[model samples]
Target: MTCLPLLASASGAAIPLALIIPFVLLLMLIAVMPLMVAKVKHWWEHRYPFVAIGLGLLVVVYYLLRIPGGGETIAHTLEEYFSFICLIGALFTVAGGIHIKVKGSATPVGNIVFLAVGAVLANFIGTTGASMVLIRPWLRMNKIRLGAYHVIFFIFIVSNAGGALTPIGDPPLFLGYLRGVPFFWLIEHVFLIWLLVIGLILAVFFAIDFRAFKKTPSAVQSEIGESDTWRFEGGLNLLFLLVIIGAVFLPAKFFLREIVMLAAAAGSYFSTPRAVHAQNEFNFGPIREVAFLFAGIFMTMMPALGYLEQHGQEFGFKKPAQYYFAAGSLSSVLDNAPTYVNFLELAETTVRAEEPAAFAALGDEKHAAVRLLLERRPLLVIAVSLGAVFFGAMTYIGNGPNFMVKSIAESSGVRMPTFFGYILKYSLPFLLPILALVGWLFL
Candidate 1:
């Protein structure tokens, strides 16, 4: 439950490759099962918990019965699992308490404005928070012109890239913050990278959405009637959200942060009315699914991540861009926060060796290791941070919010793409090219 070393041993050797299969199978189940079977899709969706737990337990049993350090590995993964679920569940609950209603036509410009606002709000409220608050409004606004592209772009902007500015914005950055990286350090170093990625993606969205808007028939009317006004209900949850952020910002222990977040969620839940939740169409399905699936992922990925922490330098992660692609490629399937932590440890090793005095001055105190690493390689930090946040859009499970957004959109009758379809058809074609360009220009 405490801080963990990135590598299984400081000596640098890979773990057994077999340790990764359960993780791979889980991803395959997530990506392939829905497409391969039509009627069973709903069953697969609801029954993912069994599939995850069964496979996860296989790895646990292997470690518990067969390996020496397995107990420590399981413990670390469990700590991360609890923190991940707590933060995600709390944010989901609190955001669900607030509902926004829009009464007007769903114009392309208006839609762009709405998304742009969300992109900015993501920096403050966390991507998951902003997405939960804004997505329903976005869906309802563009109900007439709905397409898969809308949700896809939503994942790219509000759920990922927009969260680059602050630690609270995304899980990876928050992990970085908890490791002693300064709060403003993230915003300062990544400001241009954020500007470039967010600006370019927003422009691309406007172009695509404008074309779609032009082709749509003019008879589509606003669902909320013709008047143009906006109203917000359950505004007290905003105060609860601020309390959650305050807890995160304080120099509290990890468990304390979890407690604060859960308390905020509890406050929101008990304070808000049933009508508000009904208006938000909020329920526990998305959060529950995320918790179950990620519990398995966090458990299965332990040895693999531990191995990477030790031997990552052997894989030629000597340059900033190398770390970017390496961490990001894995992050596209694995949980990005753990992936970020693994790379952070890997990068820390190289930095500590290179700048012993700088790191020594920072001291070997509790969070000092990460603080020293953060100061050592600004470019490497930038790459790791950007990679974790940006490439997370590659899959539904890449980041926590991706699947939650998909679930919400689906419940609202937005036919989201199947997992593989999402990657091959949309992500590979659209996002990959942009990622390549960003790599060329920035990383």
Candidate 2:
């Protein structure tokens, strides 16, 4: 009985418009307001971005604070917040300015290719593995062609969306494999969605490049046979990627060991053979600001996630698609790995009735039961897996590398938005509907 086709398409079954209508309206409101405000106050508009983020964060904090449980509530808050803090701490300790320097004269097209290559490589190696190898070259390209949209755009589409095709592409997906989804199942289902988003990004880029060409903007112009020398020299901060990844997954007994290893990784980055640092020619100060900004975000949103845990089921999701969208929607803002686990935990208890003990024993691992469910009922496990990995692009923080790309993009001069602000500005306007269309047309 879902009145809205798109909602059902997104959720894979009928749901009342009464519930979805406000959310769509809210997305519309959120998507458009920033542009409206920015247009009006051009002077102080940027300041409101942070203030807007703060207000949204306050709502999340209130959710955490309002929980009426005893020590359990406090414990949940501590666990969630500590996880958030530790993830942030891990990134910063790794010296956060992740970038790469490719050989030859860098062009927007060349860089796009580089990102595409990096995306494939991220999955084959770990996402962190590939990001480390390429980020310095990517940053080097930015230094040579500063002020072009190509740099930040690469970070946005590739560093985040690009990685959806593989488990190694993002942490949440890897965790899904741990829970039960086969590694290849990801590529089998998600490939088309990846192509659709990539194609749209390339199309938008062509248009931006075309307009830049028409305007004859000096900054946008690619040089003619210019020096043809790299002048690279940026911090191929690949080690930073490793240190951060290790901190998140390492066992508790190995905490101090991980810290020392990170210190070593950071130390070694300073000694890289290629002088990519010379290309940037700026201090690491800006990337540091990105770190500070995210710390505030992580600290504030922990409790909101806890609150969602306490009450997410009331939304009445019952299909793979519903979990995909809800989990992803939150993953866009929250860390996707944990969000994936949370929804998975919820879905474990989602079945309406136990299977006849014969079949029900299979219910012990619903994620596995989901793939084998077929026409009997929707496969909720597949829904969670598809949503967890695919929807990470819904917002920046869904996966670890997303923030890294944002940090790199800001350092490159894109002047990106705050945590919630990013979702309103980038994800909703551009990424959201694209994903919804994919859900309807393919997923």
Candidate 3:
């Protein structure tokens, strides 16, 4: 969800700690269910929607019955959720209509180049768009010796860190843009940091991939590099893709943006030939899973978001590095969009408390507070933006595209890591270090 309303109740009273249980339980279920024994795993695979929805309803019921203005809060959240799913579903559907075919298997160098291009493309079409469009071709080119690391690195680069340059690149930045951060502000501020992080991660991926490449037979390696014939199909879907991207700038009232996205999806689906759909193995399974799970996530997270809004200043986050890690840590588990918003609000609160006269002088011109933050403490804004976008790579649920990529990979017969395994093996070891270094050097 992009723009969640900061709860009015957040300023009135503290949320009870017990209300956060459902959110924690849902997260635990997501992390542990797939790793269970075979029978339990099968049960979980089929029944997770019920668990997610049931837990989400518990919180919804509590809010409706107990809290003031709770219905409006829930309605706004559902609206945002609808907008979120529409954009994701539209991108998935349109991307599925276009097919890319490569006659030769990708060598390590070829794979690196592909990911680098995907990283750059993410800025223009968004991480979700770039991931959906390129993931199939990425899988096809590496089918000969695909590994879990291949998918993990794809999530790290194409789906997450690559999108730090622009608001269109990631949801958190887009929300920041909606809240009055300038369009080019992120590129101007974070370009060097983005370049360094992307470069280091690509280097790490290349080293691992090169080692794996050496294990392949010499003849197979030669064959992989032999010929590079590329064919493009369903070129018209590109227009539909552009329509979906452009719709993001539309006002959210009355679902105008979501309607445009769904219309574009339907147009692409109906106009494309079935042959392209068959080649891409297009289906609604992945998107359906995301819709259900995130339904619970958006609902159950209200209390946590409310709690953070009420108590965030007590955490005493004064430095840019503090905002970076604090926001990044929550973004690892929570949806980065709202995490970015809560932290942005917190930063604003802190600044206003410290300098009331400076804030008073602005006198409430639209977004004057944010503009003042940019003027006096731009680094805080940069920290929260980077943390939310970059650390979304830490878990499957951290970003919209990460789980969709995992589901698509699994459907294509790639065995992906479990949720905890992903963090321990890839994020903690690889991504966290690079992020920490960036924070140390830049923030």
Candidate 4:
């Protein structure tokens, strides 16, 4: 169960608050059931469909009967759902084929270095790509002394915050790029906030890791034993990785992007020897789980997004701080890619109403959007960008890498935090304070 921002309704239409109860209940179930019901500890993997599918059917029926564009919405949603699952599955499949073998005990400093390097790599390779490449070695090295906080902090930095500086780094930034925003515009605007968030989070992680490192038993440390050189295998998969990147920039209408990515995934599977997959311990289970759960998410979110698109400005969310929290809060649970586009649309529409000619200039020129954004409503763009990326660290579902990283860690024998445990224990206490600081400083 999960909640996303629901619109008030279209054009003064009075859709009842109860119209969104199913979505809220689903989000709540996803958040609370694991912690409350032992049977649901793996609900996302095994049992989510009961709730997801049932509620999804209800949503489909309601829209078909009551809404004007309901059928079209459903078709579009199915398209998006397939696209989302395909891209995520392809990335997971390709990344899993490339294995990094390490021969060393994971010291506190060494672990920090790995995460730091991953944080930087996320920009060029994407959060999903970087996480897949580095997560196994990170887990194996720290296996003897691993703690839940290690995974938590890794998600906060490497899986989420590290991707802030480049459009290729995160999905929301990529959307901005596809729009008129320049490739380096994000770096120019959001670099300082990214550095501050990463720096503060790293400091907190080092302190926690130092304590955990000291508490590790000598017997366990002895199991890690010796150090040797590192080896990388299945280098051919790197070519497939490039294929996935190239496909992202392709037009979505012809289904070329999906076809290319799916083919690359298949190519990686056939070309990569079974031994490499064994080394990575790769399987389709996690991606399948994400695909199923997100199918429900996309189905249910259609109306809610429709409402937001139509009625968002009516809610009087004119301030940058308002967009920051509103967008970020939803991005915490919803897919940040669409959430980013939604808020971007809202921001652009609001700005255009005030200065139509200036905003129109943004369309014809390359960096005009960035320039107009920086000059007129810089905070709005920054808020939307930062909120989408940073708040994604709040939940396992917030960003693509968040779930992938969790699944990888669990496969490596690390006990990751539950969904609610993540929000209540880690994000609320740690990330929220930092977010508040970011708002106070920048927004």
Report clashes for each candidate as comma-separated counts: 0, 15, 0, 5
> Candidate 4 on 1-443: residue-level lDDT in tens?
01122121323444444666666677666545544556557654467877787887888898778776566657766765666566667777887788887776587777777788888988866787678777778777776777788888888888888998877788778756655566677898888888899888888788888887778877766766375558899899889988987887687777888899899999998999899899877888767666766677666666556555455567777889888998899889876776786787677656656677996766645435345656789789999999999999999888877877887788778887778888899999889899879988888
Please, what is the TM-score per model? 0.86, 0.57, 0.86, 0.80
Candidate 1 residue-wise lDDT at 371: 63
lDDT of 2 by residue, 1-443 (tens): 01011111222322222332322333333333434555554543345336434544553444345433323433433443344334333333333244343454455466557666766665544554454446555655545444435544555565566667665566556555444456577687667667777777666665665555456556545552253444323244455555555544454353453464446455644564433334333243433433334333433433333333344457676666777787777666555665665666456435423344434555444344334332244346556655666566665546555656666667756666666666676567766776677666653
- RMSD of model 3 against the true structure: 3.3
Off by over 4 Å in 3: 1-7, 10-14, 103-105, 175-183, 211-218, 333-338, 357-372, 395-397, 403-425
Candidate 4: clashing pairs of residues: 1-26, 1-27, 1-30, 2-26, 2-27
Which digits, one per residue and each the tens of the lDDT, describe model 1 over residues 205-274? Answer: 8888888877776665334236446889999998998888787655455588788888999999999999
Is 1 or 4 the stronger prediction by TM-score?
A: 1
lDDT of 3 by residue, 88-185 (tens): 67877887898887665677888889999999988876788788878988887888888999999999999999999987788778767766788789
lDDT of each: 0.78, 0.50, 0.84, 0.75
When summed lDDT is taken over every stretch of 10 residues in candidate 3, the lowest stretch is 1-10
Best-fitting candidate, scored by lDDT: 3
lDDT of 1 at 345: 75
RMSD list, candidates in order: 3.4, 9.5, 3.3, 5.0
